[model samples]
Every structure is written in C-alpha cells, then in structure tokens.
Target: MSTQVFYFVATLSILFSLMVIFAKNPIHSVLYLILTFFTFTVHYVLLNAQFLAVVNFIVYMGAIMVLFLFVLMLLNLNKDTEPSKSPLIKIVGVIAGGCLIVTLIGSLKAASISSPLILKNPGLGLVENLGKELFGPFLLPFELSSLLLLAAMVGAVLLSKRDEVEA
Candidate 1:
C-alpha cells in the first residue's frame, strides 16, 4: 500500500513538474509548480517527515506560490507579448529533453539501493531536532540563505520600481 502510494505521488509530481516547464502561460506554469510542490509535501508526509511537509506546504505552496502569482499578475503578461519559438529550436529542445530522460533512466537502472527504506532516527525530522541542527552546525548556511532571499526580494522590488518609472 505504501509503495503504491509512493509511486502514485512520484508520478503525479513528475507530471506536474513537466507541466510546469511545458505550460505556455506563465500563470499556468506557476499553478503546475504549486501542484508539484504539493506532491512534494505529500511525499514528505509519507516519509513521516511531518514538519517538512508542513514547512513545504506553508513555505512553497502558500507563500512562494502566492508571491509568484502576484508577480505574474503585476507583470500583466499575455500571449501577445510572448515570443514565438522557431521550429528548429523546438526540435532541438525536444531532442535535448529526450536525451536527459534517457540518461536519467539509464542512471536509475544502474544504481543500487544499499540501505533499507527506514530512518535511523525518526525524531530527526521533528522541529526541535531540526532547529537544534539548524542553529548549531548549520547556522551559517541558514543565515546565508535568509540573506540571499532578502537580496532577491530587494532586487525584485528595485526592478519593478524601475519598470514603473520607465512606464
């Protein structure tokens, strides 16, 4: 039962991920990305990483996706503004994607799983444990990531303001 559920979620995640990339409309792509994130959350839950699932839901689906949609709406993009791809470029892209898929399949087929599908410490996914780990050895990386996000937000705001001024 668990294996079946895992495969189902994995398949859905892959499909949604592909949809995110292939969707012509930016809004539709963002929606597909959100669905992919939801599947990731489900996978986390199935792995018993409840904290990770909640974090994924809140951070990716709730916050990031809303931000993405807001930006898309603000940009007011439409089909008319979208550029058309050349037939040759499209063919090349398809060939590249097919090659990547084949490579992934080949690698997976060659790989071996040495460990059992069980966690050594189930509490590792708990908030307390994660917090301890984060604030301890991973403190610098955590702070750096927050700073990076802050920089990205500032950059977005500056770019938007510049666009407004130009208009």
Candidate 2:
C-alpha cells in the first residue's frame, strides 16, 4: 500500500516536472512547477516530515510561486514575444534530453539496492525534534537562507519596477 502510494506520487511528480519544462506558456509552466512542488510536499508528508512538508508548501508553492507569477505578469511575456527555435536546434535539444535520461536510468540501474530504507527514529521528522536541531546548531545557516530568499525577492521587485523621469 505504501509502495503503491509512493509510486503514484512519484509518477505524478515526474509528469508535473516534465510539464514545467515543456509547457509553451510561462504561466502554464509556473502552474506545473507549483504542482511539482506540491508533489514534493506530499513526498515529505509520506516520509513523516510534516514540518518540512509544511515549510515546502508555504515557502515554495505559496510564496515563491506567487512571486514568480507576479514577475511573469509584470514582464508581460506572451507567445508573440517568444522567439521560435529552429527545427535543427529543437531536434538537437530532444536528442540531448534523451541522452541525459538514458544516462540517468543507467546510473540508477547500477546503484546497489540491497538494503531497504530504514527510519532510524520516527521522531526525527517531528517538528519538535526538527526545531531543536534547527534553532540550536543550524540557526545561523537557517537564518542566512531566509535572508537570502528575502534579498532575492527584493531584487526581483526592484528589477521589475519601472523608473519614472520628470522632464
């Protein structure tokens, strides 16, 4: 039962990830990316990492995606504005992607799977356990990451804002 659920979620996640790359419209791509993020959150939930799942949902799907959409809308990107790739270039890209996929599959096939995953401690994924590790030893890095994200958002806003000039 758990394996089936994992496979289903994993399949959907892969499909959504593909859609994010292949969608013609930027908005559609963003939506697919959000779906992919949601699938990742679901994976976290499956792993009993509720805290990580909530953070992934709120930070990635909620805030980052909204920011992405806002930037996309501000840019006013459309099919008409997008440049068309040559057929040869498209073919080359497809070939490259296929080769990459084959390589990834070969690597995975070679990996040893003798031992199944074992959750050392079920409490490891709980929020209380996570908070202790996060706030105690990992505090500086955690705060730094948040600050980095804030800086990126500010940079995006500044870049999108239009400047006005008075004659």
Best by TM-score: 2
Clashing pairs in 2: none
Candidate with best lDDT: 2
Worst 10 residues of 1 by lDDT: 158-167
lDDT for each residue of candidate 1 in 28-114, tens digit (9 for 90 to 100): 999999999999999998887789999999999999899999999999899998778999999999999999999999999999987
Candidate 2 residue lDDT tens string, 99-167: 999999999999986787787888788999999989999999999999999999999998888876621
TM-score (all chains, Cα) for each model: 0.74, 0.75
For every candidate, C-alpha RMSD to the true structure in Å: 3.4, 3.5
Where in model 1 is the C-alpha error above 4 Å?
Answer: 22-24, 91-95, 154-167
Global lDDT of each candidate = 0.93, 0.94
